[model samples]
Target: MEYSESECHYRIKIILIGDVAVGKTSLLYRLTYGYDETIRPTTGYEYFNKFYLFGDEIAQVHFWDTAGQDKFKSIVTNYYRKASGAVMVFDITNRASFESLKDWYKELKKFGEEAVEVIILGNKC
Candidate 1:
């Protein structure tokens, strides 16, 4: 369930970042509007909005789903600074994808808020 901006108490900025084909877009779609197996590779970045209940408050979460290709790294990091939280995703079946999470975490820490909360998703099991 979701509430309009007026009904919500506050807004939150969340980012989904990871290596290419690690299912960042899939995760976002699954949670927001249902997953599509044919989801194309995100070009630069994409925006999505969903309301989640946080205790008694409904926070309008603004999601930034970033392109994970190296070519987009420069563009993607720009979205990191203001994020209140991040979902760092990796394909559980891919060892390389799992290893690259460290790099992603470092980048997020370097650019995101000092107290940004991060949750990891071992996706595609």
Candidate 2:
């Protein structure tokens, strides 16, 4: 199946989840909208879009930034329902955050889309 030069379009839906203050939202912002020093906890969830131009093809990536607050855990699970990929974040400076990655991974596998690709990211910030 070959897509014509003008017919190629791609979209990827990725969810970012982790313990609070692990920089999930910060990473999303830096990747899609550039850096902002004031990092805040995502309330429930926020949507971010990043687009890449590949010759005639357009690739649009959708990033779902989920809150790290325990109160938002249930809400975050709901965001995982249709994700294509997931980025589990942790703070490298915080041991607890790193240890919690396993829990995040477990939740992703349990509630995220079957066969969803995931990568765990450790943030220094």
Candidate 3:
């Protein structure tokens, strides 16, 4: 978990995007802070940082959890500017959330770096 500056091989910025109440915040909470029964929607954005080892390389991962509300779309898209990767989350049981993935993908492609990697997450599955 500890790596000297020279030992670190990668620094990745990851952004999470999805429709409101789709468990984006909950997923981030579990990843960074462990399991919590209480789930709250993100207001604007929340960030978490951690280090991981990949074989002999060390990577610093930055996770940006953005608010999923329509009102916060602009703010969330702004954070996508320099993202190295993105996780587009959707609730498996919610048809609307799945429908919104196209919009999210458009925004991601527009604001994020051209080479940014993307993964689709079916949350609450």
Q: Best candidate per lDDT, number?
A: 1
Every candidate's CA RMSD: 1.4, 4.3, 1.5
45-70: candidate 2 lDDT, tens digit per residue: 99987777788677777899999999
Candidate closer to the true structure by lDDT (higher is better), 1 or 2: 1
Tens digit per residue, CA lDDT, model 1, 4-114? 899898889999999999999988899888968889999999999998888998889899999999999999999998899999999998999999999999999998899
Model 1 CA lDDT for position 52: 83
The per-residue C-alpha lDDT of model 1 at residue 87 equals: 95
Residue 125 of model 2, lDDT score: 45
Q: Please identify which of the two predictions, 1 or 3, would achieve the higher lDDT against the true structure.
A: 1
> What is the per-residue lDDT of model 3 for residues 9-125, given as tens digits with 9 covering 90 to 100?
998899989999888888888887899988778899999887889888899888999999889988888999889999999999999999999999999998889999999999895
Error of 1 at 109 (Å): 1.1
- Give residue 34's error in model 2 in angstroms: 1.5
Q: On a 0 to 100 scale, what is the lDDT of residue 107 in model 2?
A: 90
Best-to-worst order by lDDT is 1, 3, 2
Clash count of each predicted structure:
0, 0, 0
Worst 10 residues of 2 by lDDT: 1-10
The candidate with the higher lDDT, 2 or 3, is: 3
Query: Per-prediction TM-score, please?
Result: 0.92, 0.88, 0.92
